[model samples]
Target: MQQSKFPKYIFDWFGGLVLLIGYIIGSVIVGFVGVAGKFIFRLDFMQKPWFLMLSNAIVFCLVIAAFDFLIVRPKTGKKLNFNFSPTNFYTYLLIFPMMLGMMFIGEFFTAQIPTTGPFFGDYYEFFENLMSGLTDDPVLMVITAVIMAPIFEEIIFRGIIQKGLMNKGVEPWKAILFSSLLFGLIHGNPWQFVGATLLGGVLGLVYYKTKSLLLPMLLHGFNNLCSTLLVTYTKNESFAQAFKIPEWEILIIGIVLFSLFCYLFMKKNKVHYSDI
Candidate 1:
């Protein structure tokens, strides 16, 4: 990897600030669409979760495109070149356990956090209500949460932000950490943040190593789909309750799976891209 003479590309604070502005712009765009929809079609879609997600996807695409084409192109004379290279399909399949493991561990640890405080309690309620709505429409949930969400989220977090930082000379570890922090904060809930950040770090590292977005996207989609199914069927995101196992047992299983993922990730196999 060649290092640039520049200051590793802040892009005006680079990580969280870019996400905040994109989200604010997305919200404003969605608000306008909602108002127009209400006046013209007598329907307000702003309150719908799927519409909000769609708007965010659109905004993220535009923001990154502008950065790549208008700014980065002129400054660096190169596009960000977001990597979505193909990798071993078998290796890709194995990302499932990692997602499941993280989910179990996430739920176990988050269960310990107090959700009774005025702020946390309300946030929990709000998050629950938002997720619970997925149950009412399974197709919509699969499309928005599982498919579109992962694609756009990975494109921004790993593809754009993390890769952008690295291209500008940021160390890989620091880029992953910064991108992971922003990824966690985007969840807007501390309970989800812990797992999201950790998982984000894993995904970021994988993206950097393999130069493939497909694996991370698949892992992210699988994670969100499982959470969605858990919420839809069990009305909660607890792996213990969903699996009919004790929390401790679930936690141990999670530890084992996560450990296995670590082993497999580091163990170079015959697959050309396995340890690339």
Candidate 2:
């Protein structure tokens, strides 16, 4: 293992902090740029699909690069693993459905909680607006959400933050749990929080075991792709009502199938990291 430049405590804490700071700074930069563009060019920058998508991609890339240089590079002497293998490809096929099923389970539980009145309603509306971009620019949305997002997110959360914690002698579960929690928190809403946390835990475990970032990236991409497709193709009421038939029965069946897939995943791929 390569030695970190900072002390163990500093390295560990900074591992978590860098991403948070990066996101805040990235958002600020993007906001300022958008405002300036609107004024100087006399263009409605936000309404331009290509500009919005390109700006988002640029901001995400800059955040990743900042985290890499400021936090990851100073600590680790080597680059984070991005290697791929046939095993990773095969594992992704199994884990993608498992992760989606887990998210559905999370969604079911989330639905049971009574909203805190208007606040929750406002929050949901805000989230809906964010997603509305998909309808306006399906191609750009797909490229950003389904492709760039997974790569950027996986590199930050799994490849850098979680792996950095482990390198500093943190236990695997602690690293995975904390990183996963941060992953969910970054989504910035209660609805995504539950699902992202559960999914993050699974992805963290996969990275820890396989020691490759590729698998988690693939899984993340697939999850986002499925979500994009579902929302883009289905009307809100139609989609909700489509799942209304025997909801409990379907949930039960989904749970059982998810369990079976998880079992098979563990049985078939016995890759474990002693370091973690």
Candidate 3:
């Protein structure tokens, strides 16, 4: 790992702010273009769900890629570890199901959170829109949500933030904790914050274990795909309802399967975190 000129928090907060500002600028540019097309060309696709989703995703991709390639790399000279190394297919097979269990666990906690106020209501409405039809075009949603997002996010969070922290001589667990906390805060709401934080911790563990970004990116995409499918197809009902299983039974199953898999994985997998 190349040493970073900046600290972990600098990478987290400053880089995140840069991305946020860039997104706003990109949105303004896209909005202006859409207005021109609407008024002059009489095109109305600007309001379409896929269009909005794609625009945001593309802008984010451009901003992050540019920042990493130009700014981050120049300073740290960190290699982008996009390939899976020090690990193999068996680990991934376990991880996929393990994450599904994690999702169930995370959801149970998320459900327990107090989301009763007007503030929570707005984010809930946005989540519903995202699941239902706001990003509803299947192909585009897959391209934007499943593909673009995971690639960039893993690169930034794992490749840049956490790795840089470790390179700066921070303890591995502390680096992961700080990175995961920042990852959650980046999501900007309690609903996403809790789940994303949990997901981040899992991904951080995998990345630290294998020293590769690809593993986490794949898991991230799979997680997003599962969420998308659940909401888009099953309405807002719990997963128990979708499978026609009792809620209590599903919860018990989640806990047991999670415990079993976690124990097995921890026992079976030995970690080599920095072969890259």
lDDT of 1 by residue, 121-173 (tens): 88888887766666678888888889988888897788778877876688999
How well is each residue in 158-245 modelled by candidate 2, as lDDT tens digits?
8777877887788999989988998999898888787789889888977887776778888888778767776677644122335665
Q: Which pairs clash in model 3?
A: none
Q: What is the lDDT of residue 200 in candidate 3?
A: 88
Better of 1 and 3 by TM-score: 1
- 30-73 in candidate 3: lDDT tens per residue? 78878887889898757677667767766766666655665566
Best by lDDT: 1
Q: Say which candidate scores most in TM-score.
A: 1
Error of model 2, residue 169, in angstroms:
1.8
Q: Would you estimate the TM-scores of all the predictions? A: 0.84, 0.84, 0.80
Candidate 2 backbone collisions, by pair: none
lDDT of 1: 0.74
The residue-level lDDT of candidate 3 at 238 comes to 57
Model 3 alpha-carbon drift over 4 Å, by segment: 1-17, 76-86, 114-119, 246-248, 271-275
Better TM-score candidate (2, 3)? 2
Model 1 earns a TM-score of: 0.84
Candidates' RMSD to native: 3.9, 3.8, 3.9
- Candidate lDDT (C-alpha), each: 0.74, 0.71, 0.71
